[model samples]
Target chain A: MTPLRHVFFVSDGTGITAETLGHTLLTQFEAVEFKTTTLPFVNSPEKARSTLDFINFIAKDAGLRPLIFSTTVNDEVRAILRTADALFLDLFDLMIHTIELELGVASTHAQGRAHGMANQQKYNSRISAMNYAMEHDDGQSTRDLARADVILIAPSRCGKTPTSLYLALQHGLFATNFPLTEDDLEQQKLPSSLRGLENKCFGLTSEPERLSQIRSERRPGSKYASLAQCAYELRQAEQLYRRAQVPFLNSANMSIEEIATMVMQEKNLRKPTF
Target chain B: MTPLRHVFFVSDGTGITAETLGHTLLTQFEAVEFKTTTLPFVNSPEKARSTLDFINFIAKDAGLRPLIFSTTVNDEVRAILRTADALFLDLFDLMIHTIELELGVASTHAQGRAHGMANQQKYNSRISAMNYAMEHDDGQSTRDLARADVILIAPSRCGKTPTSLYLALQHGLFATNFPLTEDDLEQQKLPSSLRGLENKCFGLTSEPERLSQIRSERRPGSKYASLAQCAYELRQAEQLYRRAQVPFLNSANMSIEEIATMVMQEKNLRKPTF
Candidate 1:
């Protein structure tokens, strides 16, 4: 039987950074099964002690020393958590010292700074980008289409909306998506709303089988969910993209992260500075 | 003048894991200015060499040793990146060895597994959650409100939409948001669509001034953007939350990430296993 390990992502902030790095590290070890939990905002000595007790209890119950991925920046809190009966890997402690030495400066050791609302302008821009994506979603309105950093074009159910939202939310990019309609595809040209914006447009296509499956969940046994219809739309969309010289991607097997990254790279879109 | 540093987040996959950790770490050092860039999909020795070259060029141009936080899992690529004229910090290499020793196993050393579509079911769930958030945004449709893991309720500009979308996108939570209308606030009752789901509802309130400022950007010089209106709505919303026994938070000073994390923690909502 494969051994099971309990992993905890402990941080003084959102714990997102710890969880993200921990998950990425754990994915490399395919032989071990991990049961993971995130304990965020552990900024105080009291919370740190309780967290230690919980980890020690879990270690004793599981009969294995649990693994901890922590990013605590407080010296007092870090001291409290250092005694956990686990493989305590304080991520910040492990690297901050070296960074301090290299840069000849001391870390502030402040808690909850990683994901706080410290930069109001960046936060507002992020929210604005999200609102832009929402307003321009599925070509709902072309009122401010030219203001977009990138516009994703795809056939319906080909993974445009999620990618658009991810770009806006993650990168603070003014992203919009438009679903290719039959009229646009039949004409073998870009959508009327996207005629002169070919340079700012990116297209997404998916395998017919995958597209059909996705559409079937939304509207079962309908022409829109038919494989033939999906294939026809995809072919026409690809042709339109080629004729318009808009960079495109096949998103059948790509996650939204991958698609968003590819689109940003292809379009040379830099995230709005935060 | 604060010292300026060039930092690179280099990775074999989407580089998000690298950038996330690097950013979190850099936030601790407020005395330095960091000019950051991300180089993703550096899975090959060729790409790694080019990455090294770029770092070297930047270091030479800026007359400072660049900081490279890398997560490349391939030995060949890591070897190439190790030769860069910078402070090379391989995140995976630093920690993967310890983890392997603890697990009594060798890592897969796979590239691009962190954010790829290795698990299709999880990807599908994330997409589905995003779609649910969109379909139920601002109480657009309450058809499947019961299916939501958590419902966010707030005034129109109190930040319900971004929080809802973040919860769905980041954590794969079935999150729906409802903008509390004037009638709902005056009645001091939950939305009729959310009457039975109070336990699953989380309220968000902001400072009156902050709320007014945000609304003013949307509809300038309107009653909705007035300080009196914002204060009245917030007071009523807080009363409604207390009366209904629903948990709430003040989001005036919290980022969407912070808001989502707090909601997940308060509601005891676990991210669906991927």
Candidate 2:
């Protein structure tokens, strides 16, 4: 068994980006056990000094160099953390210099600009998108169907709501989702509400075995959780997608982020040039 | 102004984390212009070789090395990428060696484990929480009030819905929110639906100027969007929080990520020691 090691993600802002990067890297090495901690909003020199001291203490106690993943952009604060007995991976300083050279421009070296609340329009758009996704979830509010940027059609519990919400939150795209009902599946036809709006429609399907496993958690031993039902629904959904020429993806192996992004990409909801 | 440079974020999995970290780092260099692109699920050696070739071509075209931020774990793939004519910063390879040395364990050298669909329970919990957040968003549904791990109270458009959704999507926390209506503000009392759940309640307040600006976009110059009304509502909300002993934060300067994390930390809805 591998010994547990200390992992710290420190940042001047929310620390989410640091944690996401650090955690993804750590997940690559399977045998190691990591006790990870995140310390956010360490924007000041004093705070950085104290955090470095704490990391040093942890290194001494463990008799190994603790791993540090940091995203602080301030030079004074970063200098303080460099003194700690750890492998300091300063994400900002590592690549920004090369990018500056390539761009042939001086950097601002400003703090808190990444996720700053400076753009009210973008922020409001995200909020409004979130609300729109929630309102139109599971075909609840079809009144504003014309306003939806992308409409997801899938059976119940096939990862629709979460992906819809993710698209809205991450990209400020208005997304709505509908659960394909039994009648629609039986006839392999688009739901009446979704007939005229096929241009912006996207479909999500999955393997029947995996879909059964997922449905079993919510409704044990019911027909809805049966493998046969999942297979039938998935087959009908695919047929509908093919007949209607609507682009679709199988969500059996992809995460919510992957599904949301692929739909956004193939449907041209996000401008790739941007 | 800086020259335009191509920036690539490559990953074996979803690539969201790599893009997030890279984007945050790039934001600090304000004067530089970046054309950022993400390539996800780069898990194979053949794909890695093709990606390297593309990167080298971009380098030759622009007369400068493109910047790549990658999280690929496989050694064979990393070696292929190292031959590219670009400044390669492989986030996974950067720290995995130190972690393996500290833990004294051989790595599994896995691919796609970062956001893989391995843990079904945790993934389902996140979905459930997102649904819960949507159901109880902005005083929408109070039926399952007690099921919420945290309840946020604030005036209209004070960043409640986004924060609640973030807490759920990131941490699998069941969060609900309600807007403090004018009657509650005038009386300076917790809403009747939220009175019993005061122990789990949190509050968000922002500057009157910012609040007015945010509200004016939704309701064009209504009393709710007036500066004086915003100030009055904010004052009453603070008073109510003090009387109820609910912890609060000023969202005027913080992002949705920061607000959600701080609330989760202070409310103990999450185990901070973890």
Q: Which predicted model would earn the best DockQ?
A: 1
Cα lDDT tens digits for candidate 2, A1-274: 7577788989887788778878776765666667887888889999998999899989999987788889888899999998889878887666778656655666777776666664666777778888898788899988889999999999988888899988888888899999989998888788899878999899999999999998998899999999999999999999988998889999987778778768976887863323
Scored by Cα lDDT, where does model 1 land? 0.90
Candidate 1: docking tier: medium
Q: List the lowest-lDDT window of 10 residues for candidate 1 chain B.
A: B265-274
Tell me the spans in candidate 1 whose CA falls farther than 4 Å from its real position.
A272-274, B272-274
Per lDDT, the best of the predicted structures is 1
Question: Per-prediction interface RMSD?
Answer: 1.5, 2.9
RMSD of each: 1.2, 2.6
Error of 1 at B49 (Å): 1.3
- What are the models' TM-scores? 0.98, 0.92
Docking class of 2: medium
TM-score, cand. 2: 0.92
